[model samples]
Target: MDEFAALTERNRQLSKAMMQSVFELACDLSGLGPFPEQAAKARGTAPVNARLMQIQQLIEQLRADLQGLRGPYLMQQLQGLGVDQHSRALQLHIGSGPYVLDGWINLDVFPAQLSTNVLWGLPFVDGQCRYVFLSHLLEHLFYPTDAMALLQDIHRILEPGGVVRIVVPDIAQCIAAYQDGDTGFFRDRVEHWGAGDGQATRLEHFLAYAGAGPDPAWLFEAHKFGYDQETLIRALQRAGFKTILPSTYMASTHSALRVDEHSQIASAKHGDRHYSLFIEAIKE
Candidate 1:
């Protein structure tokens, strides 16, 4: 791997380790079973306690180091892309997984040749980008605070009157389906997308459809939170976006803001269209 890729991998490893350590600390403090035996053995020892504190301090330092690396790393990526910060015509697709547009910079967190992690912040001067697009990307973030921060970042990078199109799974539609006794719609369409083999039980299906799963990777891919129209509008307004309006698949108020049909359809199964909510907001 290249230097940037190697650093990114190392950062990811450190983040995972930090999370595990935090969980263990919680378990230890709570007197919960399944705490590491090593931790249990070292619990009452002064030297071990001092070492644990040192390790935590080291982790905090490493996290700060990683944060410092992000800006320069993203600037390098932009340089490689031949992107100019002064260019007013720059458009971006954030969290753009395998969705390439001819005239836009497509970015994602995954390790890909074309994708870059956008969580660091947009690699542009304020008001440099004319348009931004992200579809079904917000729900993966585990915190609403992070989501709002990202939206505000996007707003900061966008030019005056620049539009951002967002699409997310409609939580309202999911609730309606559940209430209307169309559980199969949620089960078959959202959870599993294959011929019925009767593999999962009803409870398992419901949990999976609701974005709860046992797999560790699900923490990254599964929906952490859901939003209805009003909630999304409020978030946009909070992010300094005015003129927020509802939209539909492949449709927008301006022709220039049209959704990429290839990307949109490729992201969904046959009957999954109705489950998505599309909205556009302008930075004014």
Candidate 2:
């Protein structure tokens, strides 16, 4: 393993050990919480149990916070104006890989208006953006952790009634096609993007670019997770978004958020559906 990922894994191991120790402490304290007289504890005079519960809650929060950490390898790439509290443009195109918009800020790892890693967290203050769009970016981040962190951070930065549009590969459709032995779907998916060998089987084409090998750089660009319409909408709801809906290619209500990958648009132009799941959520 590389130095950075090795350090991260070691840190997580250490943290899990520490958390287990802390949870044991909490459990031990619970037995003594009502000691020296259960009456006083019942009357709220002895607040040991209450205090223990608070500590446990804090521990859970800290565990979640651990996922927010970014190794220096990734953190050093965070460049440009950190937090644009004064940016008048209300639209943000995060992870904009050549889908740069006219008025919105194009943010990516290479070169854009804001070249930084979103995994660390968004640099903008709360309610700074009216519309946020990220195409094929969520799947790149680790699911239920980095992905959720970014979604929650996006929700925090979006203004009330603001919108967040997410576009990702439709794993649901891929699985359906595989189960039905629909070679045409898999063939079209691979050919539409010209990203993989068209002759590959459904399973192979589905996971085509999931890291060329164990190399850290390749893994960094690979799809770490997949999501369907239901799971994605549920995640958005958990992020505190009020209204969530499944959308279509280039059919977003907001003109600024309609920008999508050309492959998705072209595939949809010829067929009723493509291998992209488009979903939108409104922060309220």
Candidate 3:
């Protein structure tokens, strides 16, 4: 870690020095200040200019690559493909890390159906999809901006009357369990994820998802925002969705979206309380 930090600083310093040298030479050459025959030698800058142009092109390409993991856009551009109406329905599992749904197109940043970053936008025409499933992904997006952008895009891509099932770590449930000192709840969660022996660590289990594993996939699941039932409902409503409902494990009206990791975790003892919030909303 120390070596990485030192190397990063050294690279920045070297880049700054290189830029300064280039700028000073360019200024000196332009005015013929250093040498009497500098005007004739000015043509030598053509190679430097060409190299800078190439560098600019490379920088622009990197900018696009960083932000333009646009799966649908790339599909259309590279493969001449877009999500057309499926023979049945266009179902999308956005941010589906490893849980690949058999029938639905598993779209995620973790190299699923397409390496898609949902924060940019879904790669489909408006009203092309029938159902979208977001599993424990919303909280990872920054609140009211990035999170809301994803929600608004989901509304736009769904056919009218289409549905979105959102899941997130239930902040309210976690808080309640902590207040009531429900060790069993914490115990179960810790055991399932295989960490957190104490009350505080177990509580941390529900709040944070990102720093748990070495995999980049888990790194993406960091809880940037927290959501309870009412807060989630209001966010959905703002995104132009209607008919929002607080749902439960394996109880979705949409049969295909009922596929979740929740059913196994929710215990029979704690009134079947799930560690994650399940909510569904309609694009109306």
Q: What is candidate 1's lDDT per residue for 1-284, written digit by digit as tens?
A: 89998998897777666666677676675685534446657785445456678988997898799788777777777778887756786778877777677777888876543445556666779998888988878877654677888899999999898999988877777677666767566455644354246565555544554556534523555666677899899999999987998988778777766755747432454264556788999988
Q: For each candidate, what TM-score against the reference? A: 0.80, 0.66, 0.66
In candidate 2 the C-alpha lDDT for residue 173 amounts to 79
In model 3, where do residues sit more than 4 Å from their true spots? 1-61, 65-73, 76-88, 196-219, 261-271
* Residue 20 accuracy (lDDT) in model 2: 63
lDDT of 2 at 239: 93
Cα RMSD (Å) per model? 4.2, 10.9, 11.0
What TM-score should be assigned to candidate 1? 0.80
Distance from true location, Cα of 242 in model 2, Å: 2.0
lDDT of each: 0.72, 0.73, 0.71
Q: Candidate 2 lDDT (Cα, whole model)?
A: 0.73
Query: Which portions of model 1 show Cα errors greater than 4 Å?
Result: 1-21, 32-44, 47-49, 112-116, 190-218, 264-273
